[model samples]
Target: MKDDEPEDTGSTLPRRQLGRLLREAREATGMSLEEAARLMEWGKSTLSRLERGKSERVRIRDVIGLCELFGTDEEKTAAIRELAEQAPVRSWWRSYGDVIAARFNTYLGLEAGASELAIFQPLIVPGILQTTDYARTLDRQYFSRDTDEELDRRVGIRMQRQHIITRQRQPVQLSVVLHESVLRTTVGSRQIMAGQLRHIADLSTRDNIQVRILPFRAGFPAGIVVSQFIIMSFPKDSRGKPVEPTVVFAESFTGDVYLEETGDVRRCRETFRTLQRATLDDRPSRDLMREIAREHDSER
Candidate 1:
């Protein structure tokens, strides 16, 4: 099999993992895709798309039918159905066409579907939580030549993406550790920075989100600096293994980086833990946020 081929070991995309499970169950019952589709009253193409991960969407009722047809255990049936429900929702980001780089979108899709996300940002706020004004200010300062329309659209996409934290039945659990300088840095006007700090404070109170600050006093124990990365973990599958190996996303000036190998994940996780240890707890972080807000108010 090709290196990128979906593994039957259950370490793959949700759809691919589900497909492999379905294939296993069907074969155990000596049923083909056509036979199974017919038994479930689904179109042949529908089953084909599902098996290929081209269409990962499925209803609980359909899962029930498959379970009954294949005589699958209730546990397996439940896990498969959950994967279908947890498939990443299609978003307007898709409309960006080729403008948004593929690596970025791939990470976004993983973020949208992740049950939990952990990030360590040394220089800036995590993108999903960045305020529109802050995002625009950063874009303007960095890309002065870019048209206003382009900037606005980028900011709009970012705001929409933030919904991943708020709109879901169980909002994605987010734990972010940002460097202390991020709070002190004036990305926008003084007023905007103050507003941004207050916003961060508000978001930290959210039940599913936690924000911490890593002070410079911690020094560079990990031998890394000025890098931001996120780790996404998917819900488990029928076999009780994580659906996909954790994916690490790192951004650069010109393009992005995606790390899926085991060694990279281990190093990123270690770095995250190291940063976590150096950071203030959530309560203290909130206090720092309020302090910044007060400073902004005083300057005003």
Candidate 2:
């Protein structure tokens, strides 16, 4: 990291975020990725990976070249370059590479510094809110090919990530909207399911956390085809501007997709608002969670 650059007090420090800015700059200049690669006299894949943040390291000179080519101002150029310098710093997630998906590593980097996280789950509970036993069961089912040790590591990581929700310094504002069915589904065992529901209910009481439940009677929001997704927003900078653009993160069996376009993010925000309108508020949601937990306990 550059000595002069201010400490990363928000989610924008990730190389992925820096790459996004560079990509946007290139697009704003009306230059194609291929055209820019040719103009810079670099291989097309190198430029592609750098812009996509797949490249492990980014050079300050390359960032400067792109900034100059894109006609960025001094302040923006400096911000981008500083992120490049921090790109190589190993994060806590690095140790869990054996269990974490390559595509998810970027999301982890972004999630840690997000100022707000809104998640919509149509099936299982969001991993960030799962209890250790609940997470272990889900991980084992999803990553069936992994060994026991890998499953344990993956569960550990999920639990650790929950700290962001209640962190001492600027805890992330968490808003979760869950489909009613998610509470009804039995993951590991009836006991585990009961514990998980109770845990979420407990978290709902925290000042920074908000939990809502969308009952089946409410029906699905129009134009939202995905089963689950998360929208993460970063805090404002010293200038009172967003540190980074809002990102909507969706994951599938294949890989993770991050949508940073203004239109896409706006639509997602709208969908979340619609769902929020149709769901039970925090108090009722917590009551429903306890009610479901009791159901599970009775089943056990």
Candidate 3:
């Protein structure tokens, strides 16, 4: 909030993620913040700001210093440095600044950096799996007042986000569990719904993607309504330790929540597993969606 240290909302998520990681590493060594800063030749306040995620900028050298002091392993240290590097890098989603909410912006960054995404939807198709017409229809409904051009831009953003799945370099692994209602519920029109369903089925054939549908006949897991949510985890180190902590994203009518704490992530993860267990296997799920899409086509 200081005059000299202006807000950097664009890279907020990565910076905060980096800060949390650094704080955790320091705590593991039982080093007091003051003592750690002193050893690193950094001002106590400077170190405090980094740990609290208020630093205007993050320095790679400073991050490396802390990693060395904490005796972090090579792969882990490299991962930490990568976070520091990403702290200031602006993401592509920022181009749609006018349409993106602050919280959703945070999600875009996390989604871009994540190595794996596990999503559960009790309603319509998740944005990542949504086709242009389907996304355009939803956007038109939600942004009723917006002009056609604005709506197109919004739809464009959603379509671009799907690229991460198809990206050639270490494309993210995606596991999605959709409620049968998602396929049964027609979005824009029967045509749109059919196309969307087929698109999902096609994508499921990819090596990195798995889409499953939980039928209503299967019953809700534990008779509780599990709303839509996504659990994203970052890439791992050579030793198989996660580079960044897993985060769970839950969206509602009002806003979005990011759960980064260990316990909350664990619980959401278990919930996803429960939903997954109640769903059809990957191949069956893909076939089922294709069949449903054919039904929608017949309706048309």
| lDDT of every predicted structure (CA atoms) | 0.73, 0.78, 0.79
- Sorting all predicted structures by lDDT, with the top scorer first, yields 3, 2, 1
lDDT of 2 by residue, 69-146 (tens): 999987677667656766343231222232234323557767887888999999989988999998888778879999
User: What is the per-residue lDDT of model 3 for residues 165-209, given as tens digits with 9 covering 90 to 100?
Assistant: 998888989999999999999888899999999999999999999
Name the regions of candidate 2 deviating beyond 4 angstroms.
1-100, 223-226
lDDT (C-alpha) at residue 73 in model 1: 84
Count of clashes, each model: 0, 0, 0
How far off is residue 52 in model 1, in Å?
Answer: 4.3
Question: Which regions of candidate 3 are displaced past 4 Å?
Answer: 1-104, 237-241
Tens digits of per-residue lDDT for model 1, 1-300: 012322233233555545656777888998888988887788999987776556635666776677788998866776566556544422112222233342124465677667778888888887888899999998887768879998998789889888988875888888898888888888877888888988988999999999998887878757767488887776667766555556777776666555666666677888888888888889999999889878977887
TM values, all candidates: 0.67, 0.68, 0.69
Best by TM-score: 3
